[model samples]
Target: MNDDMRRLVRVQEIMVVIDALQEKIASNPAEVARLEKDLLAAQKDADADRARVSELSKDRRRLEMDLMGIESKISKYQSQLLEVKTNKEYQAMLHEIETCKTERAALDEKILLEMEESEKRSAALRSMEEMLERKRRETSQGKTRLDAEAQDLMRQVGALESERTEIMAGIAPAYLQPFIKVARQRKGLALVAVRDERCGGCHVRVMPKLIQQVRRATGLIACDSCKRFLYVPDEPSRAAGAGAESPAQ
Candidate 1:
């Protein structure tokens, strides 16, 4: 290959590297959003568990108050027994005392049940809290890992831009606009190889004469089907170059 074709090959390699870097950069927002969604779910679950435990606590308190009121009525009935004068009055007081005792028994049962439920709820809430905490820790760790990945990708983008600037300086000005236009259309893949006597970009078999001319690396050649610049690889590009899909024989 001569001087001009060699420059196009180098430009193509730089463009491929830039493509991979851009792809990495483009995915960062989605990755961060996925992590945030997980954390949000964990937080929502924790809040629901907390509200359930609070409701149980309120129910337990209400039951305790009911039990206390029953006990007070029993005390008042017992005191009224002492103040009774006739047998009828005494009998009436006894009836009142029995009714209070029945009400007190029912209240005691309700209190016991509420207490048991509250205990179970409290335990479940504690477990949920622990799970939420673990998720928060994992979120922190994921953010750290994502930051490192983003930074690494940023470095690659910077390096690619620098490499692009250096490449732009070396290539002919007349070729730059065409190269940029093709690169934009094909995601940094402006130049394609003539492999197996076909245009790698369009997969249409290049004429044998065109291949022979490209192998000589005389001037830029465009594929009829894809309209992309085509070249025949030299010693170095053939050994190390990786590109898009090529045509079958």
Candidate 2:
């Protein structure tokens, strides 16, 4: 192909790479958001476990206080039994003492159950906290890696853009302007190789005359169907023949 066509092809190739890198950069934010969401869910689970443990502890304390109050009542009733003046009064005092003891026993059972539950919940909380810590570390590392990758992608795009600029400088305006217009209209694909007598962009067959003109590489040629610049790739055998002839010259 001619020098101008070669430069155009190089610019298109560079643009394709830049577009892919930019696409990856654009998707980074969504990936970061997903990481944050997982970490947040873990945090919420740990917080809920901590709250449940606290509630169990509070219940245990309340049950213990009730048990103490019942013990105090029983102690007062027992002391009065010694001063009773009649059998009926003494029996009544004994009954009151028995009722207090029963109440105290029920309170003790409740307190024991509460303590057991609190211990179980506390253990679960510890496990949850450890998991939360792991998630935090993983999230931090993931975000850091993503950030580094984004920065590297940006650098690659910058370098490719610089190369594209240098290639564009060597192309004439007459060719560059139409290429830019077509590339804009065709999603940055203004140039395509003609293969098997077909337009690579549109996959439509080209006339013999147009195919001949493209093979000659004499001027800018466009596919009739897609309006994209078309070029014939140098065949290996033809390139070899040209090389052999050039040595004679």
Candidate 3:
């Protein structure tokens, strides 16, 4: 390939590198964000579980207090039993004691049921605590991995950038802007090879005149169909950048 084709090919490679770097940065940021969301959801679950337990405990205490008050009333009624003198009064006291005992039976059962439910709630809370702990650890691990990868990518970018600057110096400065514009529009694929008389960018047959001009390599040439710079590679089909076949006869 001639100098013009070579320049375009180098520019294409640099754009590819930059795009890959952008994707790497985007991917890591997304991972970090996803991990943070996981941690937040787990924490919310733990909070809700704790709140449920707290509410149940308060309810249990209230039931116990009511039971105690009922018992005290029964005690008062019992003390009154001995002080009664008439048969009618004694019978009335006996009825009142029976009624108190029935009410106490129901209240005691309710307290027992609440205690059982409270135990289950405590178990659920423990499960939530465990889940929250695990989620936090996972979130931390994800961030650590991202940080390490980011550092490595930065180092690679630094080395590649130095190489890219050197390559850019070899080409005329006037060619650079059109190169960047084409690369951006074409998904980092500004340059393509013409093989088998087809425009590699569009896989379309090129006009005889266009192919004639491309072979000269005097300046950048764009495919009419895809508007990408073209060169004739030695092979029928080949990838561009960092590799090539010697131009065919």
Per-residue CA lDDT of candidate 2, range 15-34, in tens?
99999999999999999999
Q: Global CA lDDT of candidate 1, please?
A: 0.77
Candidate that scores best on TM-score: 2
lDDT by residue (2-83, candidate 1, tens digit) is: 4545565666776677677778878877887898898899889888888988898888788778878878888988998898
Residue 61 shift from truth in candidate 2, angstroms:
0.8
List the candidates ranked by lDDT, beginning with the highest: 2, 3, 1
Kindly report which residue pairs in candidate 3 clash with one another.
Answer: 194-231
The global C-alpha lDDT for each of the candidates, from Candidate 1 onward, is 0.77, 0.86, 0.80
**Tens-digit lDDT string for candidate 3 (1-249):** 565456557667766786698689779988999899989988988898899889988998998898898899889989999899999999999899889889889989988998898899899889889888988898998899899989888778788778778777777666667777887798878888887789888899998899888877667788999998887753325334333443432
TM-score ranking from best to worst? 2, 1, 3
Compute the lDDT for candidate 3. 0.80
Q: What CA RMSD would candidate 3 show?
A: 3.2
Comparing 1 with 3 on lDDT, the higher-scoring candidate is 3
List clashing residue pairs in candidate 2.
Answer: none
Model 3 lowest lDDT segment of ten: 240-249
Error of 3 at 96 (Å): 1.6
